[model samples]
Each structure stands twice: as C-alpha cells, then as structure tokens.
Target chain A: MSMNDLIATIKKVLEEVDVVLGWTRSPAAGVAVPARFHTPDEADGAIFDSTCTHNLAVHLPRLKNSKVGIVAKGCDARSIVQLIVEGEVSRDRIRVIGVPCPGVIDVKRAWRCFGFGKKIEDAGGRVHMEGRSMPREEILLHKCHQCQDQEPVIMDLAAGDVKSVTPPPPPDKTGIRERFAAMSIAERREFWREQFSRCIRCYACREACPLCFCRDACSMQTREPHWTGGQVNAIESEMAQQVRTSHLAGRCTGCEECERACPVGIPLMLLLEEQNRIVEELFAYRAGMSLEDKTPLLTYDVNRDGGWR
Target chain B: MPKTEVKIIGFLCNWCSYAGADMAGTARMKQPASLRVVRLPCTGRVNPLLVLKAFREGADGVLVSGCHPGDCHYNEGNYYARRRMEVLERMLPALGIDPARFHYTWVSASEGAKWADVVNEFTRRVKQVI
Candidate 1:
C-alpha cells in the first residue's frame, strides 16, 4: 500500500486507541523519531520512509497498562514478541500495525550518498536525498540486508497487503569470528581503546535500547562511592563497555539502536552480534525469535545433555 | 618458555566441589596453590559475566567445578551451570582470550584425588600460556 493509505489506516486506529505510536521525521533533523498520536488529526505528519529506522516496540512496555496502537516493521514486531515472551508487556494491551520495510538508511551512508562536498538539509519534515547520483542500495542500513525476516512475526492489524519475501540467509558468524581471531592482541587492544576513547559516557545508547529496561538504578549511575570513576578514561571505558555488553548478553534483540544512538560511531552492535552468535551456537537459541521461547539463561533443566560439565 | 605466574580463580559449588576441595586438603593430596577458590551456593549461580570478570581482573585462568552433572544438590544447578559455561567457552576465544583459560569440570565430594588432578592440569596449562 502507498504511504498515504498506511497513514489513513493509522489515523483511524489512532482515534480508537489511547495512543498510536509511530515515526515522525525529527523536527530538527533528517532522522526519524518516535511520536505518539492521541488524535486522528496528528497522523498526517507520520511518514513510513526509508529513514524510519527507529523501532516502535521500545515504547510498548512503557504503555503496557494502557491500550496502545503501534506502527511496527518486521524487526519491531520481533521485539514485541520478545517483550511478550519475557512478560514485560501484555499482548492484549497493544495493537501492532505492521509495515514491510525494504531497509532504512544509516546516517553515515546518507552523508556519503550526499557526497563529501554537498550537504543535505532537513526542511519541513522531508529529506532531500541529493548528491552525485548514488544508488539507493549504497545507502541502505547494513542490518536490513542481513535481515532474515521481512514479514511481521506478530501483528493485530497489518496496514499494507502482505507480501511474501524470502528471509535473508542466517548470518555468517564464523566469518566474523575469524576476523576477530585474525586480529593481533595489540591490534585488538588498540582498536577497542580507540573506539572506547570516543565514548563520552553519554547513556543515549542505554536509553535508546528497548530491552535495557533498568531505569534510574542503572549500573552506570551507582555513585555513592562510585564503582568506577565517572571519567571517560580507559579503565572506566573498559568497565562501561564490559558492563553494558554483559547486561545485553542474552537479552539484546539486535535492534541496533544503541549503535545508532552513539554519537561517537562506536561499533557496539558488533559486540552484541557476537554475543547473539554465541547464544545461538551453544543452546540453539535465538533471542526475539518467538514469544513462546524462554531465555535459556533463566530456565533450567536437569536432563539436558550437550553442555560442558 | 619463560615461567609466568598465572592467577586462577576457582568457583566451587558449596555442596560438592567446595567439600571436595576440603576433602582433598584432609587427604593431603598435592594440588597447585595458584587457585583462589570462591564458594558459591551452587555452580548454577556462576554467571558467564563472572568468568569474564575474573579474566578482566587479571585472572589468567578460571575453573568452575560442581557436583557430577546429575548429582547437583539443587537437582539441576550443575546442569544450568554446564549450559552457561559451554556457551562462554565457545565465545571466549572470539573475544581474544584463550579458550583453555576457562575450564569447567565436575568434582564430587568424594573425588578428592580427581579435584587435585584437575587443578594441577589446569594450572599447568595456564602456566604454559601466561
């Protein structure tokens, strides 16, 4: 369906629900931002563009007690299923209006698309994608190409007509593991040191993550005596990286929001992807794959056979 | 090879592995003194992060020992520990740590000799690398 038809459906649904959560072009930027529509009239600004990279599922748990209507893409729907499985949100409290996304564009790719000399400006809720005739494929988000599922896993009301699309192939984690293995110890240390040095201790990544639900009591915020000093030095950087990565070990849904939110352009998703790969290899488990599957870490079995001990 | 002093942290399940270590001491079984044992309620309580944290805190090696798989005092504690450790073992090498540095073994309360042997072998291997 056209973007107009999708917005019209969302308008109707927004009038019936307490709130309709969707993406609106950020007022000050070329990026998409999450917005809540309580009235049908406000739906005109909602756009389902290639820049709509924000996963709407992050808002569901916060509005769990209230009836909410969400505009979700495939990855967003997967996150919803995961939240339901974890008992973080009730399925009955939310209505998912699914959309099939081809792929969203990364900001760096957008910059490159616009060319080194040219600058693209955001004006009146529209992005002018201009430069030296760059192909659209060049600007697409890396995760979208690797996305295995295009159809929403769970949806109460799908907006566009359902289209049968082949899921992307399973990620080649062995290749990725080999790349890391090939790096020398000094090279690995230097790489991480440079990446972590750029981190300004901005918790935007944590705040943007849908699964990182811990609020004020965040590990990074403990300061009575200060577990690790608040400085963005190497020791503190390493601690922060370890703490953040470990927290998302089994829980990360591979949303990539944390990486996107990082102003420093840290490849945070690589760490998460590695963790996801490990989880898959060991237990044959995938996070956000199904609402019915419980986390392997939280569940125990006496008769289970294939483990180390 | 130059001999490097390797620090090893051993997490022993209180019900079995810790008792097994005590039994080994009572039996005067010779074991490597490089290990620092932390008594946990059960091996299942050992989060993979703790193992990583051991390495982060300069432990050259980590050992998690529990009751024989089915003999968990909590019935399924060791089984859960086994699953977590197995996953950690597979992932550690990718994170730039030697996979052999993290070891998981089952030591029953009566297996004093076995516990000593496991520690000696693990310490020796860690020494070779560190």
Candidate 2:
C-alpha cells in the first residue's frame, strides 16, 4: 500500500481507538517526528514519508491506559515486542499498524546530498523535496543497508501488503572483526579519541533509544558524587559512551537510533555491535529475538549447552 | 628492606575456593597477607561489572577463584563464570585497564596448598605492576 492508504487506514482505526499515534513530517520537511491524532481531521496531516525515522512505540506507554493505535515500522514493532515482554504495556491495549520501511535518510547526509542554501518544507503529510533531487543512495542511512529483518515481527493489524523481497543480509561480522584486528593499538586509541571529542552531550542518542527507559536516573544526569562529570570533555565523553554502551549491552535491539541521533557522527553502533558480537560468541544469545528468552548476562543457568569453561 | 603493599580483592566460590582458603589457614600455610577474600554462593554470582568496580574503587588487583569446571556445587556455575571472565578479559585493555589485574583460576577444596600458591603469585604480580 502507498503512504496515503496507510494514513487512511489509521484514520479509520482512530475513530474507534483513543488516539492514533504515528509520524508526521516535521515543520522542516526533511525530518519526521512522532505526532498523535484524536480525530480524523487531525489524521489528514499524518504521514509515512522517507523522513519518518523515529520509532512511534516509544511514546505508546506515556499515553496511559488509553487504547493506542501505532504505525509501527520494523524497528518500532521490535520495541513494542520488547515493551510487552517487560510488562510496560499490554499487547491487547495496542493496535499496531505495520509499515514496510525502506529506511530513512540521515539529515546530515541529506544536507550533504542537497548542499547548502536548500530549505525543506512540510506540506500536509508529504515532504516537498524542493531544493535538489539527489540520488536516493546518497542520502540513505547506513543501518538500512545492514538491516536483515524488514518485516514487522509482531503486528495486530497490518497496513501495507507484505512483500517477499529479501532484506539486506545480516552484517558480516568477520569483515568487521578483521577491520578491528588490522588497527594498531595506538591508532585505535587515536581514532576513538578523535570521534569522542566531537560529542556535544546533547543526550539525543539516549532520548532516541527505545530500550533506554531509565531516563530519570541516568548516570549522565546524576550529581551526587557524579559518576561522570557533567561536561563534554574527552574523558567524560568517553566514560559516558562506555556507561551508555554497557547499559545497552544485552538490550540494544540494533535499531541504530543512537548512531542516527548522534550529531557528531561518532559511529556509536560500532560499540554496540562489538558488545553484541561478544555476547553472541560467549553465550550464543541474541537480543530482541524472543520475549521468552532472557538477556544472557542478566540470566544465570548452570545447565546450558556450549562448554566455554 | 621495604615490603610492597598490594590491594587484591578475591571472590571465592563457597563450595570450593572459600573452603580451600579456610583449609589453607587451618593448615597454617604461609600465604600472602594482601588478599581480602569475599565468599560468594557460587562463582556464577560474580558479575564482571563487580570486578571492574573493584578496580575502579582502587583495588590493585582482583582475583576470581571458582570450583574446577565440572566440580561446581551447582554443577555448572564455574563454566558460566569462566565464559564471562573470558569475554571480559578481551575488553579490559580497551577500557584502559591492565588485563593482568583481573585473574581467574580454578581451585578445588582439596587443593589447599594450590590456593596458597595462587594468592602468592597473584599478590607478587600485582605488586610488580603497582
């Protein structure tokens, strides 16, 4: 189904549900943000554009016990599944309208593609790409190329007809590990030092992550004998990165929101991908695959297979 | 001659290493006096983060001793502990920590003499690094 059809389906569902929560083009047409519609007229402004990158499920629990209909892409559905597994939200309380997303473009990449002097505008639900028409490949997010699962894992109500096209294959870890192995110890340190120095401490990466639910007690914001001093210096930034990466070690769903939200382009996913590789190699566990399965690090069992010891 | 002081936090499994340490003391074996032992129900209970926390809190070294792989009181506790430590060892240098500061060993209750040897070697190595 096309973008218009998906919005129309949401409009029909919202008449019965308390609210229809989904993405709409931001005032700056190049971006999309989560928005809610209580009435059909409000739904007219809803969109499913290339700029729709934010996972709508993050806002679902905040809506209280009210019945919510969310437009979930592949990543959004995984967040919904994780939330249900954690008992944060009931599956019955949510009506998932799944959309097959081909991935959204990064704003920085978009700027690079279109060059300066170009301005973006959101007209109703569509992004009017006025300034310059660059090749789609030039502006697409990197994570999209690595995405293996494009189909919604869990959906109560589907919108677009499911396509059978195979998604890009699972990332070749051997290639990644080889790249890391090739780097000299000193070069690796210098590389990370340069990447972390650009961090601005905006916390958008934390805010964008669906699994990072501990926003209230985040160590970055703590002041009592501060774990990390509240500054963007190299040491503090590196510590913050370590803390954030460790916190998401077993829980990161690999949605790539943290890397996407990073204004400095620090390649935050590299840290997470490395952790994921370690967990998989050590315990043969994968996150966000099943609600029944517990995180390997957090769960203890004496009788499992694979004799590592 | 001045003696070097090394702060070493040792996590011992209750069924084996803890008993081994006790037996070493009962046997009056001459072990290093620097080791501070914390007995846990099983080695599986020792999270790698706790070991990192000990280092971050200024311990010169950390030692995690569990039952020999198959001899865990709970049957496989030592196995899980071993895997966790193996992975953690790889990431230690990346976190700017000397990998030698974190040690993992298999000590059975019968090996009271070996427990003394483990502590002596660990304390000596820690002193050298510090």
Candidate 3:
C-alpha cells in the first residue's frame, strides 16, 4: 500500500482507538520518528518506508491511554506478543498496523558512509547523499543486517504484500561468543573492567528497552538496600552492568535499542545476543518468538537437563 | 600457583545441605578446610546474583548444594534453584568466566560422608583451576 493508503487507514483507526501511532519524519533528515495521530491532519504526516526503524509498540502503554492503534514490524509484532503473554500490555486494547520491512537505515553505519555530519534521505536501495547516491544495502544497522521477519507475526491490518516477500536468512552467531570466550579469565575481567569503567552510569540502555517497563520502580533506582548506587566506582559499575543485563536473562527481544541509545557506543547488543543464545540452548526458550512459548525462566520442568558441571 | 588452600564459598540450603554440612562435622569426617559456608533458609532464597557477588568478593569458586530433587524441605525449592543455576552456568562462559568455576549438587542432611567426599573433590578441582 502507498503512503496515502496508510494515512487513510490511520484516519479510520483513530476513530476506533484513543490514538493512532506510526512513523513520521523528524526535523532531522533521514530520521523517521514515532508519531501519534489524534486527527486526520496529524495522520497525514505518517509514512512507512526503510527509515521507519523505531519499534512503535514500546510507546503504546507509555501513551497513557486505555486503547491505542500502533504500527508493528515482524519483530515489533513479536514484542507485542511477548508483552501480552507476560501480561505487560492489554491485547484487546491495542490495534496493530503491520508493515513490511526492507531493512531500516542504521544512522551510525550510515555515518561511516556519508562522512559523519551530512544529512540525507534513503530511497529504496539507494542512499541519497545530496546529489550523490549508493545502494542502501552497504550500511544497515548491525542487527538489521540479519533481520529474519519480513512480515508481522500478528496484525489487525497489514500494509503492502507481506505474503509475497521472503525474509532473508537469519544471521548465524558463529564466533561472536567464542571471540570473548577465547580470552583468558584475567583478560576477560580486564576487558569488561575497561568497558564498565567508561560507563558514566547512565541507564539509557535500560530506559530504551521495551521489555523493561518497570521504569522508575526499578531496583537500580533504590537506595535503602543499595543494589548498586548511581555512583561510577569500578565495583558499582560492574554491579550495575551485572544486574541490568542479568535481569534480561530470558526476556530480551534483541531489539538493540540499548546499543542504539548508549551515548558512548558500547557493543551491548553483541553481549546480550550471546546471553539470549545461552538461554535458548539451556531451556529451549527464545523470547518473543511465539506467544505460545513460555519464557525459560518463567516456566521450568523436573526433567529439564541441568547444565551445572 | 601458591600452596594455599582455595577460597571456596558454599551456599548450603538450611533444610538439607546446611544440615548435611553439620552432619559431616558431627561425624568427624575428614572434610577440606577450603570451603567457607553461608547457610540460607532454602536454596530458593539464593539469588543467582549472590553467586556473582561471591566471585566479585574474590572467591575461587562457588558450590550451591541443596536437597535432592524431591526432598526439598519447602517441597520444590531445590527444583527451582536447579533450573536457575543450570542457566547461570551456561551463561558464565559467555561472560568470560570459566564455567568450571561454578557447580551445584544435591545432598541430604544425613549424607555426612557424601558431603565430605563432595567438598574434598570440589576443593581439589577448584584449586587446580585457580
């Protein structure tokens, strides 16, 4: 479907729900941001394309309304399923507008191609840099390089021909974990020590996470028992890192928003991708894969094989 | 490596494993001096974080001993703990920590000789690693 068709649908959806959510162009070039549509005029700005990268499902509950219409990608649709399964969001209240994904422009990777500070728009497979152009294939975000869902798993209304599209093969995580595993214990400790040391203790990774709906009620903000204070000491730094990532043991969706939001550009997703792999191997659980599949930590069996050796 | 004894931290569940350690002492069984025991009400109370905390506090290794699968005093506490530790051990290597540095087992309060054997065997292995 074209942008006009999407706008018409949004206008129709707005009549049913409290609000309609979709991607609209931000003031910055090459950036499509989450936009809430309360009226037809507002919905006119909504567009669907490669630039529509933000997973809009996260903003649904944050809109603070009982019922809302939101757009979802294959991955975003899975996030909605996991959220509903966990009872984090009400399924009956949200209307989904599933859109086909052709790999969103990862701004950071584009920076390496377009020379750091230039603003540009993406047209299909071409990166339009002012008057110059190149294939958009060269600069996908690290996670988008390996997107497996070209179509939404669940949707109230789907835009474009999802059935005709075939998803590219999922990226194999070969050598990713082994790269860190190959390091000596002391080398690994020093590696993490330096990484955590750069941490200014900003929990942007935590805040940007969709599954981390706990918000301010997070124990990271606590002081009485002091799980790990906001102070940036080496011990506290590692403590904070340990608590935050470990809490995502079974629930992470590999959205990589944490890596995206990090001001210092840490490879947080690579680390979490490894954790998700381990959770899958040990318990045969992959988060957000299906609503019918329970999270590994949330459910267990007496016959499950124990990995302690 | 130094000839000193390894600093092993044991999280023994109060209902079975803790009483098992006491039974080892009462029987005058020859147990290794390497282990420093911390007893909690049940293995369920031991969060995976505590094991990480023990390593951060400079422990050479961690041993989580609870009641046998069907024998937990709280009915199913050890069963849950078994699941948590299994996943935690699988994750340790990805974090660059040697998976060998962590282990868990089932031991009842009456198995004093078995407790001595488990402690001696684990202490020897951890000492070799560190």
Per-candidate TM-score against the hidden true structure: 0.89, 0.79, 0.92
Question: Candidate 1's residue-wise lDDT over A20-83, tens digit each?
Answer: 9997777556567688888777888777766788877877767767889999888888788888
Model 3, chain B: what is the TM-score?
A: 0.95
- How good is the docking of model 3, by CAPRI class? medium
lDDT of 3 by residue, A1-309 (tens): 588878887888888898887889776655677888888889989988766777776775576556889888777887788787787778788888877777666676666666755556767568776677767666555566677766777788876666655355344343444566678766877777777778777888777788878786776667754667788876777777677777888888787788777877666775688788778777777688776778777555776555334
Error of 2 at A129 (Å): 5.5
Q: Among these predicted structures, which one has the highest DockQ?
A: 3
How accurately is candidate 2 docked according to DockQ?
A: 0.24
- lDDT of candidate 2 at residue A276, scale 0 to 100: 73
Candidate 2 — what's its lDDT?
A: 0.74
Give the CAPRI class of candidate 2.
acceptable
The per-residue C-alpha lDDT of model 2 at residue B116 equals 94
Comparing 1 with 3 on lDDT, the higher-scoring candidate is 3
True contacts kept of 2: 0.04
Chain A of candidate 3 scores what in TM-score? 0.89
Tell me the whole-model lDDT of each prediction, alpha carbons only: 0.76, 0.74, 0.77
What TM-score does model 3 achieve against the real structure?
0.92
Better-scoring candidate (TM-score), 2 or 3: 3
Name the candidate, 1 or 3, with the larger DockQ value.
3
